[model samples]
Target: MVNTRDLRVIAVLISLLFTAFFVLIILFRGEIDTAATATVESYGLVAIFLGVFLLELLPQYISPHLLVINAIFLGFHIVPIILVSILGHIFASLLGFHLGKVYGFRLVEKLYSDKTVSKISSGMDRYGRWIVLLSAFLPFPYIPVIFGSLDLTWKNFWIFGIIPRAISFALLGFGLSFLTF
Candidate 1:
C-alpha cells in the first residue's frame, strides 16, 4: 500500500487524465460515441477526482446537479455513483480539511470574512452532522462551505456525507431507471 499523499497524487493524476479526455471530446465532439462515454464511467473515481481537483475552482461545495451529473451524464451504474459520491465527498471533505489545517482557522477566516466564518463556525457547532446530511440531500453548495468549516476527520465526514449521498444517488437511479429501457 502507498501513503495517503501518494494516493492523493494518483487520484489527482487519474482525474486529470479524465479531464483531458473530456476536453479532447468537447474540443472535437463530433467524433464522440457511447464507448467514449462508457470509458469515462468506468474510471469510477471521476467525480471524486473532479471534485477534489477542482475544489477551489468550483466554489468548494456540493450540489444535487453534481449528483445528477455523476449518475446520469457520467454514464456510471447506480452503484458506482453511490460509491463515487461517498468517496468524492470524502475526497472533497479532505481537501477542505487540509485547506483549513494548512491555512489555519485565522487564514481561512480571512478568506471569507470574520463575520461569515463566525456564522459558518456557529452553524457547524450548532448543527453538527445533520447539516452534512442535509447538504448531501439539498443540492446546494454546502459541503465545502459548511462541512469544511466543521473541520472534522475524514472518517466522520465520510460516514455523514457518504450515507446521504449514496441514498440520494440511489434514489436518482431508481427514479431514472423507471424511465429507461
Candidate 2:
C-alpha cells in the first residue's frame, strides 16, 4: 500500500522532528531540566505518569530515563514510579501497535534497511512471542513497530510486551533508587 515516495516523505518528516527535538534540548538544557524537576516536585506522581507516558509515546524523541531518575531523586517512591512507567509503556505500545497496523511496512522500511526488515520479519516468525517478550526489555525502541508490522495479536502484545516492560522498569527503578549524587 505504501510507495517509495511516501516512505521518503515520512522519513524526511521523522528526521526533521528528531533534529528539532535535539536542537531544543541543546538550546534549553538547563532551563528544561530545572523546569522538569520543579514540575515533578510540585505535581508528584501525576507528573511522573504523564511525563513517562509522553516519553514512551515518542520513545527516543526524549529521554524518559533521566526523567524517572530525577523523579526518584525528588523523592518519589520506587514502587509507584515503576507502576506508572509500566503503564506509560503499555499505553505507548498500544499507540505504536495501531500505528504499525496502519503503516507498519512503510515506517519500518523508512526506519530500517530492507534487508534488516526482512531479517527481523523472519526472526519474528521463527521466535514468535518470545521475541516480543525479549524485545520489551531491550533498549531498542523499534520493537513495537516490528510487532505491529508483523500483525502480532493483541493478546501476545499485552502479555509479552507489557509484562516484561513492567519488570524491567521495576528493576531499573530499584537500581536507580540506590544511587547517590
Candidate 3:
C-alpha cells in the first residue's frame, strides 16, 4: 500500500526517468546538426522550450549550455531563443520551488551530504535574494532547489532569479554565435 509520501516520490521518480530517457535520446542519437538542430527546427519553439525546461529541472542530466548552443546552431533568432529559454527556466524553477516547499530539506539532503546541505541552507538564509541572483551566473546547478527548500517567496524568486538567468543565457548564446566553428 503506497502512502501519499510514497506516491509523491514515485511521481517525481517517474518524471525524472522520463526526462532521463529524453536526455539520452538527445545525447546518443547523432551530431547536433543532424539530431538536435533538426529536431529543434522541426518542432520550432516548442522543442527549444522543452529542451531548456528539462535542462533546468534535471540539471545533472542535461547541459544548459549545450541546449542553448544547439538552439543557436539551428538559427533561432536570438531574442526569441532567449525569451523561450528564460520562460522554460522560470517554469522549471517554480516547479522546483513547489517540490522543495512540499518535501523541504529532504530534497537537498538527497542530493548533497547533510553537512553540505546545511552550509548551503545557512548561506541562503544569510544572503537571501543576492544568493539567488548570483546563482544564475555561477553554474550552481542546485540553486533553484535550495531556494525552493527555503520557501523563498515567489515574488522574490521570480524577480531575483529570472532576470539574471535571462542575461546569462543571452550572453552565452550571443557569444557562442560569434564563434567561427
Candidate 4:
C-alpha cells in the first residue's frame, strides 16, 4: 500500500521533474523559442490549440503555459490565445476526468493490490476535494485519472478542477499581456 512516505517521495520526484524542465527551458530558451516561432508561423492558431490541448491532455511533464507564454511573446492577440487555451484546457479536463472515471480504478488495481487500493480509496474519500483542487491550481501532475480513480464527483471536479484551471490560464494570459518584452 502507498503510505505517507511514498507520497512524500512522489511529491519530491515531481518537484524535481518540474525543476529539471524549467532548467532545460532556461538552458535551451533560444532553440525552444525558435521552434515555437516556427510552429506558430507554420500553423497559426491551430498550433496553439493543438499545443495546449495535447500538452494538457497528455502526461508529458510539460506545461501548456509555455506555449501561452510563447504566443504572448510572439505578439499574438491575448484574447484569442486565452480563449483557445480555455477551450483546450476544458476539453482536456473533460476527457481526462472521464478516462479516470472509466479506467483509472482498473488500471490502478492492476498495479497495486486490493489492500492498497482500499486504502487509497479511503484516503481519497477523505481528501479528494482538496486533492482535486490542489492539483487543479498547483503545478502538480494534474492527472485527472487520479481524481477519477479516487471517485471525485463530477460537480466537485468541474468546480475545483475545470473552473480553477481555466481561470488560471485566463489570468496568466492577461498577466502576460503586460510584458513589454
Quote the lDDT for 106 in model 4. Answer: 72
Tens digits of per-residue lDDT for model 3, 42-99: 6877877887787677534335656666566555677777788878877887887788
Candidate 4: global Cα-lDDT?
A: 0.73
Backbone clashes in model 1, listed as residue pairs: 64-139
Off by over 4 Å in 2: 1-38, 43-47, 59-63, 110-119
- lDDT, candidate 2, equals 0.69
Structural similarity to truth (TM-score) of each candidate: 0.53, 0.64, 0.67, 0.69
Q: Residue-wise lDDT of candidate 4 within 1-181, one digit each (tens)? A: 4565675676578658756765675567677677766766667578778878887775535678877876676667899999998898888878877877899877655444465456546656777687567666777656665577777889998998889888988999999899725
> Which runs in model 3 stand beyond 4 Å of their true positions?
1-39, 59-62, 111-116
lDDT of model number 1: 0.55
- Best-fitting candidate, measured by TM-score? 4
Alpha-carbon RMSD, candidate 1: 9.0
Q: Summarize candidate 1's per-residue lDDT along 1-181 as a digit string, tens digits.
A: 2254564576578667756755664455544545556665566467545653354223332243344443444445655555655555555556665666565665565445455466656756888776666766774345453455456655666677656665675676667655532
In model 2, the clashing pairs are: none
Q: How many backbone clashes does candidate 4 have?
A: 0
Q: Quick one: how many clashes does candidate 3 have? A: 0
lDDT measured at residue 176 in model 2 versus the true structure, 0 to 100? 76
Candidate 3 at residue 30, lDDT? 54
In candidate 3, which residue pairs clash? none
